[model samples]
Target chain A: MEFVQNFPFICIILSMFSAIVSFILPGKAAKYLHIGMVTAVLVLSAGTLAYVAGTGESYTFMMGQFPAPWGNEIRVGVLEALMAVIFCIIMLLSVFGGIAHVEREIQRSRKNLFYILLDLLLASLLALIYTNDLFTAYVFIEINTIAACGLIIVKKEARTYVSAIRYMVMSLVGSGLFLIGLSLLYGITGHLLMTPAKEALEKIIAQGTYHVPLVVIMVLVVIGLGIKSGMYLFHTWIPDTYGYTTPTCSAILSSLVSKSYIFLMIKIFFRVVGFDSIISSHLVNIIFVLGLIGMIMGSVAAIKENDIRRMTAFSSVAQIGYIYMGIGLGTTAGVVAALFHIIVHGITKSQLFISIAGLSDVSDGKQDFHSLKGAGFRCKIAGAAYTAASLSMVGMPFFSGFVSKYLFASSAMTAGSGRLIAAWIVLGVSTILNTVYFMRTVITIYTPVDEEMRKVHGISPSKTEQAAMAAMILLNVVVGVASTPIIRALESGLAMFG
Target chain B: MDVIINMLRNHYQDIAAVFLFVIGMTNLLLQQNLIKKIIGLDIMDSAIYLFLASKGYIAGRTAPIVVDGITDVERYINPIPAGLVLTGIVVSVSVSALMMALTICLYREYHTLNLDEIMMKIRKEED
Candidate 1:
């Protein structure tokens, strides 16, 4: 019972150890091991969440014996606990949803390596979420990057290599900037721990000394993470990376990887710098404007894309922009809304990628929407799943997307004054743009075909896949319908953040 | 102006590090060859390491490891930055290796080390 205080470390080490062991196991055994590990972590994360929620308490675990100021530590509140649970659930669901394609795409021998990388990536992600020290965050960011690159090239194709190299280069640049920021901050503060750093920074700000360096640190870190997370202008690598990977890889990368970087960014914004300082420095303004651009640009790009996966990849950038916009509002409700959108978008986007694979199966692996005509009639489950996901993405009434969008818009509105009109107008335009592209793709899938074409194009999901897709769809609905309680929980969770 | 000059002179190692960082970043951004770009990556990382190590410098401080009967805290320079740089070096090595491997794969496929040429070939193939 008392051991649950150590659940954060337990979660991290469990995955790392599993990653090592999985590397030696056969692919089949590695997969089951993967499932078992994810399930165990999920159960533990749920228990932690329940404990945090019930008791309304947070836990901190100092790695080794050193105290937090001098050594590494992990702080977990309801937000961390809940994020861990959702992350594990998404990992399990996406892997399960896209397992058949994973087997089909990856070579027989290198399959276990994929799961191994997944384990390491998940471990690093948890570290990124829970770590209270800046240097630990940087180390895990590198691990996450390497593991993500490993995931991209696991299928071993010419396009994959190109995309992987681009991903590698861009990510290195981002982390380099991030490291520079940390170095500057550490130089000034002499502390890498979040709480102490904040104290140091607040004192620095209070004295109005070294104002320029503080702004540089803020901008550098924000831009570094912005690039890593595919915030508008820095998203050039995303389509190539997401589009070339297997659907499972795409699902994982799209749903988890960028999302985690953004989570860490939000963490730094709220916990380390404090929102008041952020608003004063006007860093959120830059995030806000770029987010608006990203929303419009991403949708326009998605509209022009021919390949289904590439289109969905672009849509993901736009969804990230939506989350960024929420953050830019610079209010507590805004952060909560953005976090809510993260969960909603994560589930919906992964489902769309998985469904894209299903759609491609019907068309004999051709990815162009024109080639996917009458796909809806042939693959009923994939068609329906895609429809549900697209509608939710487009913010149809009573779906998950609408709920988050509603929350986001209202929160943005609550930030009344000069930015209010711009927020509403941009939200309206992006929503309309989102509807245009998403509905175009949906209509293409549902377009009619002649009988001769229809008979030859049948593609059915296996029972497991059918169930997985259904579960994803159900998950979206559940999140939408259960927003009241979730929001309440998230509010309290966010209140405990600092 | 003289005081500012003195301050800059006092922190010349950091100025040099910043200069190296800019050169490395320009190489990374502007170089055509993938191999050159990788060297640029190494240089950039080294620049950061130099900056960090210099930041940890305290005049006349000894090594962080304690020896027999040496007890003053200020006698040793901060070791944390060195440790951090060590980790950064290892990560940079692996990343450069990965990038090199990717470059090899790319060269084998397209017979080019140039980004523009590779882009042309890839785009032509796509078309």
Candidate 2:
């Protein structure tokens, strides 16, 4: 076996090890430890991405002596490696951008605990990405939930406490449903491994037995993950959880944490139950209609929100709706578009959160539009970065968001007339709504304040924050302009998905 | 009635598990009290474990401990669901403990176990 095959397991173990090691270390040391760990994972995943993309083959690394149908295994392919690399990059940037807030907002005694949770969260996300076993994925989903809750509660405020519990309650419900679905799947297929489960499911489908149970399992798993990913109506916990938490936590939660569940759902479609079944089951139609509703309703809610953080949180609901909408199309082009939107939204949304954090810092630590007025001019770097991110979100040409929307539009063209028309209308209306709120935010931040308010001196962002913002903007533009290769990579990577 | 009776007779365990799941889900969604919500979550998790246990159990089969060194597959029920149930229990325990810890935090701040009351207090404080 090649040495690079070990990279996936090594990355998971290393992050877990860091979580444990950081628990014992002092806060300052743990911060540096996290940086070192992220950098290491970033490098390893980059190497793995290059190798996998070059070979164009997916490899399964056995976790024990048992082979395909038994024991544990993690499959790494071009898509998974690409996701890992980008996830690590975004994580490192989020930490870099939000560490100052962490130091300031959290009590000294609990600071290390924050990093511990971050490490565990990263480990769980990596495990979710790589694990081929349904049960292993469930375990990591629990770990992800717990670690994310700790991230919220680490700030030690009444609001954070309330929001954390709400988040926990919702997460537990989601995971519980997911577990029941997996157990039922096991009962039908008698296999926990994805490949074996797929084989069994195919046989069962051919035999045409247990049709009701199969559909029930599909709905359970999809809805479970949908709730976790903050799909539309299941997004009641989103705004408070994202708005009240520390900025870094919100950035990670909105971008990577919710995204992993969606990625896992996509994996299940391709690997376990099969996308053909997903389409044939008529579940995609329901997903399609819900996605359409969420796209309109989420944006409407965001428009109603006065607080900037809550606005972004609501925007996430709309973006998640777009991804599900693409999946609902149930075409290869549509799935690819959805995957591209994942990358685009992940990079663009994190950038928005991190930059907005900087913006609010210069505006008396306020997140409302009234206080954030003129914040852009005061904090030039944050302003530029925020503007760039907002432009991307608004789907302007020459931005990553535009590329994704374009992909979605073209993908919709290939669908049936009814779906194509619905997707187009929603896409058009959603884009308009996205422009309305995001551009309003941009304009508000750049709006001039009164002389007295202008006299309040704004502190320039620290060197690290400036750099993080620059890196994010650079990534956003690079993804937008040089998107051909990335899209091609996603297409080919998806080909090897199963 | 005949179809319902057949379903109840043949799939009693699954029906009961589904009933408990629905009840737990209802409580978790509708309950105003924090502790009751946690209890609801536990009930939901327990329902899943029971479902899994039922899936693993086979009538007239011994445990998978290999009694008298019997290696025959038919001598034991499927052990995968047992393992899955164990894992589910551990996850639920930790999650319930975390929920309880958060409940304590909420109680410390608001002096109430009702989520609605707490939300009202939070609104008052914010205003």
**Chain A vs native chain A, TM-score per candidate:** 0.98, 0.98
lDDT, model 2, position A45 = 92
| Backbone steric clashes in candidate 1, count | 0
Model 1, position B94: C-alpha lDDT score: 90
Q: Each model's interface RMSD (Å)?
A: 0.9, 0.7
lDDT of 2 by residue, A1-498 (tens): 989889989999999999899888999989889889989999999889988988889999998768888779999998899899989989998888787888888888878888899999999999999999999999999999999999888888889998998898788889989999999899999999999999999999999999999999999999999999998879899998899888889999999999999999999999999999999999999888888889999999999999999999999999999999999998999999999999999998999899988898888888899999988877888889899998998888888999999999999988889999999999999989998999999999889777666543555567888899999999999999999998998899889976
What's model 1's lDDT at A402?
Answer: 87
The ten-residue window of minimal lDDT in model 2 chain A covers A452-461
lDDT of 2 by residue, B1-127 (tens): 9999999998999989999998998888789998899889888989999999998999999788965988988988877788888988998999999999999989998999999999999889879
The TM-score of chain B in candidate 1 is: 0.92
Q: Write the per-residue lDDT of candidate 1 for residues A53-82, one digit (tens) a residue.
A: 988977778778687678778988999988
Pairs that collide, model 1? none
The list of candidate 2 runs beyond 4 A from truth reads A450-459, B1-3
DockQ for all candidate structures vs. native: 0.76, 0.88
Docking class of 1: medium
**Top-scoring candidate (lDDT):** 2
Model 1 regions lying over 4 Å from their true place: A456-460, B1-4
- Tell me, per candidate, how large a share of the native contacts it keeps: 0.62, 0.85
